[model samples]
Every structure is written in structure tokens, then in C-alpha cells.
Target: MAAILSGDRLRFLLGRFKDRLWVKPLVVCLLSIVAAFIAKLVDGTTLAQHVPEIAAESVETLLSIMAGSMLVIATFSVASMVSAYASAASTATPRSFTLVVGDDASQNALSTFVGAFIFSVVALVAVKNNYFEAAGLFILFVLTVCVFGMVIFTFVRWVDRIARLGRMGSTIEKVEKAATAALKRRRNAPTLRGVKLTSEPHGRTVVATSVGYVQHIDIAAIQAWAEENDVRVIVAALPGTFAAPGRALAYISNLSREQGLEQKQEDFDDTRVVRSFHIGPDRLFDDDPRFGLVVLSEIAGRALSPAVNDPGTAIGVIGTLLRLLVLWGEPAVEQDEQAPSYDRVEVPEISVRDMFDDAFTAIARDGAGMVEVAVRLQKALHALALVGDPALRAAAEYHGRLALKRAKAALAMEEDYTAVRDVAMFSETGSQRNY
Candidate 1:
């Protein structure tokens, strides 16, 4: 019953394309041309006195059939495009869109996927019905549906990752600078101390601290210090470069204290391997985990954008994580050991991994390290958190690294050969043992 309703919806969406301009005619014309060619190519050209009559009848029949099929295909093509637009819009979060989509991006990709599916399905159904007697036609229908769906999927990905051409001329510097500035600010924290501080982009203030203790100066003067003295480095993979937190954008080299006083923004046409989009489709973030650095920058970008500073810390974080997971593939992080005694106060009875787990049974049954091991992992985060201080700025970093390290260790443990270890492939998947 549910399947029927879904089909109806799909058909209805595809039907909408029939009324579109140029779709009906184009489809009918293409099909007509092909059908005419087939009519000409077939063995039965004419049948004597009966040949003329037979040829006339055959051409008329073929042309009619071709027109009908063309009409259906035209309608389907339009529907697929519409569905793709919707699907692309749907999956996309409301990014600063400035960074990826646009600030007001919508999640409408589902409709597009459905549209494409519906379009392809309609074409298949037409083939199944009209070409039931022709084996070649049946094969063609199946191939068409598969190819169309794959194309739609690829189109959606492209749209999601890169900006449309209309906005090609626009600059992608806001988030670009944000990532670098944020990273440099954190990496060169010691220098930022003497860097003068001022209320600039709102919520966050720019601090003009020195690379080291410097001569006292006015806030206005310090503002230009970074620029005049040339204090900053050109962070590779600039802001919006899809970097993990703690990922080195660029390294700073020898610079006089005066040069370190001011960070200047230099514009250069970089023709190197610069990725405009960070979809993480490829294993892009396999090494660096410094993407967390961009979330704050994204927030700052939104808070200061031309379209009402809509800070997107969560969006940036999720985007970074999703990209990281997809590019490098996520290890079973939840399986890692937690720090020792970090959460031991109330969970003395449980392992850190188990305590964190929703179900205690699963954790204990797994081959993760002892609860004591997880406790130590948790303790490591806590200790590092304290040392790092400024909980907001540093705690998350320490904790994130701790979590990743522990998860990685746990996965390694699972792979290790041991007496109690479980390493068997499941019969159904031919992949690995479920347990």
C-alpha cells in the first residue's frame, strides 16, 4: 500500500513535466526521428502492391509509437531536473552558503532525487508496456533507468560541493580568511598576547597582542601593526579550505619582531591545488584534525556577512566532521577506551566506554580495553583540558583528540589477534562477523 502511494506521488511529479514548455515537443520530435529511422531500417520496406500499403501502415504505426514514447521521455527529463534541484536543496544545511551553498540554502534534494527516480521509472514503464514484444527494448529500458539515476546523483553532488556559475565572479574570501585567521590566532597564541585587542567583527574582538612583549602603542596603531609589520603567514588551504582543527594551514618562518606585530592580508592568484569545496567525498582529511578550527571562523563569518551575520558554528562543525568522516572514513570511534578515572566518581562500576554507551551490555561484551583503560583515557582529556585552560578554546580540542585516539586504539585492539578476540565474517554480508 505504501509503495503504491509512493509510486503515485512519483508519477504525479513526473506528469508535471509534461506541461512544461519545450519538453513535450522535444521528446516527441526525438522519438519521432528515431522511430522514423527504425521504420526505414526494418526489413519490411514494402510488399509489392501490398508493399506500398504495408509500408504506409508500418510507417504510420511506428511514427505514432515513437511520438508517444518521446512525449513520456521529455516529461521525465524535466521532472528529474526539478527533483534534483529539490534534493540538492534538502540535504544542504543553511550554510553561510557563502562558504558552500549560500547563506539561505535550503534542503530540497529529496524532491529532486524523487523527481529523477520518477522520470526514469516512467521511461522504464513505457518501455515495458510498449516494447513488451521486443527484447531489445526491454533491455534498453533497464539500462536507461540505471544510467539516469546515476547521472542525477552525480549532478546533486556537484551542485552541493561547488557554487553555481552565476556567482563565480564573487569572492570566497570571508570564510577563507576566517579559517586562516582563526588558526593563526590560535597557533600564534603567544604573539596574540601583546597583539592589541579591539571590538571589531562583534561577539569576537580582534586582539593585537605582540609576538612577544612589545613597545606600548595605541589600539588604532596596533590595528595596522599586523599589516604594516607583516606578521601573518599565508595559511595554505585558506579559510573554507575544509581543514580539521589543529591542521596546519601554513608554517610561519623568520620574521622580525616588528614584522610579527602586524598580520597583513595579501591577495595572490593561487593556481596550486586549491579545492573550492570541502565535501570530504575523497579521503581529504586523513591526516589533519584541525577542521574544528573553522567552526568559530564560520560563526564569525556569519556574524559579519553582508546577509546578516548568521554565525554557523554547528553547521561548520558538522560539515567539517562529515567531510572528515567521508574523506578518511570514520573508524569505530565509539569503541575506543576512555581516560582513566575521569568519570570514575559515579561510574566506578563501569568502563569509560561502557558508561558512555547507552547499553552497558554491548560495551562489556566488546573487546575494548578494561573499564580502567577508558577511565585513564577520560583522565587524559581532563588533565589536558586543565593544562590547555580556557575550556571553550582548548577543552574541546583536547577532548576531541582524546576521543579520536581512544577510538582508534579500540579499533586496533579489535583487529589484534588474541585468545578472547572475535574476528569472524558474517555469512550474509561476506564482510565481517557481526559480534
Candidate 2:
């Protein structure tokens, strides 16, 4: 019962709810229903008694006009959003399509249109039935004006957002924002609020029963279970990992035969441990930095494709990746001095080396023939090497050499090859002269 209502579980559920396109629109529809009822209530109150009568003809006309126009507007907006999502999928990474579809501005705009339409339709029906009193009519008129104002404001913002919604630059910005958020969360809880897992598990390993990407982990649930069992739970997988039935999801340690069968049976619940983690078909940006990095790399790959041949977009993505890496390299902010949240739960820290590979490996391969991209990549690595730690710098140097080798093989011109090699050598040696 405690694990079921854990904060981690709640947050994971809430995050999933917010990603749906229908959630906001459905909420708006419910709110509209409530508002309609409130308007009727206000009509009977003394506060609305002083208001002048709104003619039946006038109320009918206003409601009819808004109802007709709002439906048309809502349909058009939905079509535009669909088109934008399709374009984003075709041009940028398909993984980014979810973010584009769930954009707050677009969702809010669509919700407003749907809500206004519902309000207008209900108002029209009530007015036609002569159900509204003079005060109710007056209240409805005021709300109509307010809805008009909101619709206009939302339309303006929607137009502006649609213009850049799925473009390369906008997509890069969204990925960077997501990556930064994931990095910050990891920085705070590098081991997922548990002890760091450093080696292979010698204890009983709990394998997954299904195959899917791990989306969210319920650390609170694990902590509670661990405390009850008096054992350390070492997580073998993190968010974005592909869990197979035979693969270890986590490992349990410090078990003994001293406890009776009933106690042992009650303590080790593999199903509960599996339930603590949410598995899904696709990865989410909330808890997975690797997904963001992979999406960014996808954008670079798409830009470097033969049909597109947009090196500039790839360069921009590289710069954004560097910014994300630099942020990840910085130490986490000071945390509270209270007892560690999940002392019995153990998780592994993210690898900077893996991060570097995710950010650059594919881009280097695809953009090898483009001298401009090669030189820029080399220069970027050199800059990163100056600021990054030993492991980070080592990864950067390794990629720098690989990129240079590919550049030499791809570039036919001696000058272009020399230019990229010189940059790569400087990056590798930190020397003034070329190798």
C-alpha cells in the first residue's frame, strides 16, 4: 500500500498523463460544462439582478455565430498541428515527434478552441430552449466576450509557433532543453537516490518478464521493500534500457536462511520489483538523457544525409551537444544533509564516455566526406578537451582521432586532409605544432 502511493509513482503517472493530446482538451470541455452551470446559478443570485436583460434574439445570435465559427477554427487548427507533426517526423528525428505533438502552446491553443466551441454549443442550446434568465443571459454575454479575447490571443500565438514548430533549429532547442533537464536530475541523484552499483551482482538477480524500454523507476517502492527485507537492491538497468525476460532488472543481496519460509516469501517479491519500474515501447525525455542525446544525433544524421546535405544544421547540433556535455560534466549542486533517500537501493552512475559516443559517433561517420564538418568537429573536441575531466577528455580524444581518420579517407584534396588532420592532432596532443 505504501509503495502504491509513493511520490515517485505519482510523478511518473502524472508525467505520462500530461503527454497525451486529449488530456487538456478533455479538461477544457469539463471546465466549460462547469462554467455553463455556474452562469445559470449566477442568474438567480442578487449579484446578477441589477444587470440589464440580454434579449433572446441577441443571445441566440451570439451563441450561434460563435458555435459555427469556433468549430471551423478548431478543425483548421487541428489540421495544421497534424501537418506540423508529420513534417517534424520526416525532417527531424522521429523520436522528437512526441515532443512536437505535445507542445504546450499548441495543445493549449487547441484546447481553447475546443472549450469555446463546447461552451458556445451549450449556450446556444440553452438559449433556444428559453432556459436562461435575464441574469444568466447577461453572464453568458460577458463570458462570450472573454472567450473571444482568449481565442484571438491564442490564435496569434499559435500562428507564430506554427511557423517554427518543427524546424531544425526549434527541434534542436527542444532536445537541448530535455537533455539539460535529464542531466540536472541525474546530477542530483547520480545513483537514483541509492548507493552506486560498481560491480556485477553476486546475489539473486531479478530478471524482467517483459521486453520493453524502462521508462521510470519507483525508488521509494524499492527503498521500502529493501528496508523491509533488510537487503540491498542493486538496479541493473536505468531508464531507456531495453529489458529482456532473462536479463537482470536488479539484484538482491544480504539474504540468509535464518528467516523462515513465510518471512522469506514475504520479503522477496519479484513481481513487486518489476512493478516498481515502468516499461514502455518508446523512451521518455523526463528520465532518459540518452534518448535526448540519441535524438540530437539523429537530427545530425538526417541533416548529413545525401538528399539534405545540410552541414550547417549538423554543426548547430554539435554545438548544442557540446553545451549539454559541459553541463553534465559540472558537479551536482549541494543536496540536503538528511539521511540518504534510498540507502538500501543501489543504481549505477551515467557514463560520460557513453554520453560522448552518443553525441558524436554517428555524426562523425555520416559527415566524414564533408571537410568543413570534420574540421568543426575537431575544433569542438579540442574545446571540450580543455574543460572536460580525464575520462571525458579521453573519449573526446578517441573520437577526434577516429573522425580525423575518416576525414583522411574521404577527402581527396591534400589541403583539406591536412587541415582536418592538423586540427585533430592539436586536439589529441594539445600542442602548437601539427603531428
CA lDDT of each prediction against the hidden true structure: 0.31, 0.84
TM-score of each: 0.23, 0.94
Off by more than 4 A, model 1: 1-56, 87-435
Q: Please estimate how well model 2 matches the true structure, expressed as its whole-model Cα lDDT.
A: 0.84
**Best candidate, lDDT:** 2
What 10-residue stretch in candidate 1 is worst by lDDT?
341-350
**What TM-score should be assigned to candidate 1?**
0.23
* Candidate 2 weakest lDDT stretch, 10 residues: 426-435
For residues 1-435, what per-residue lDDT tens digits would candidate 1 score against the true structure?
Answer: 332244323443353353244454445445533432232233333322232222223323433443345346435544544443443333322222323322211122322333333444444344435432233333333444454455456456646533441131121232333344333332332122222222221111122211221111121222232234433222233222334434433322214444554333332221111121122322211111233223322333333234542223222332332222232222222423533211100111111231122111222222133333233233323333333234321433334344434434554454332212222121121132232
**Runs with alpha carbons beyond 4 Å of true place in candidate 2:** 255-267, 425-435
Total backbone collisions, model 2: 0
Candidate 1 lDDT for residue 187: 38
> Measured by TM-score, how close is model 2 to the native structure?
0.94
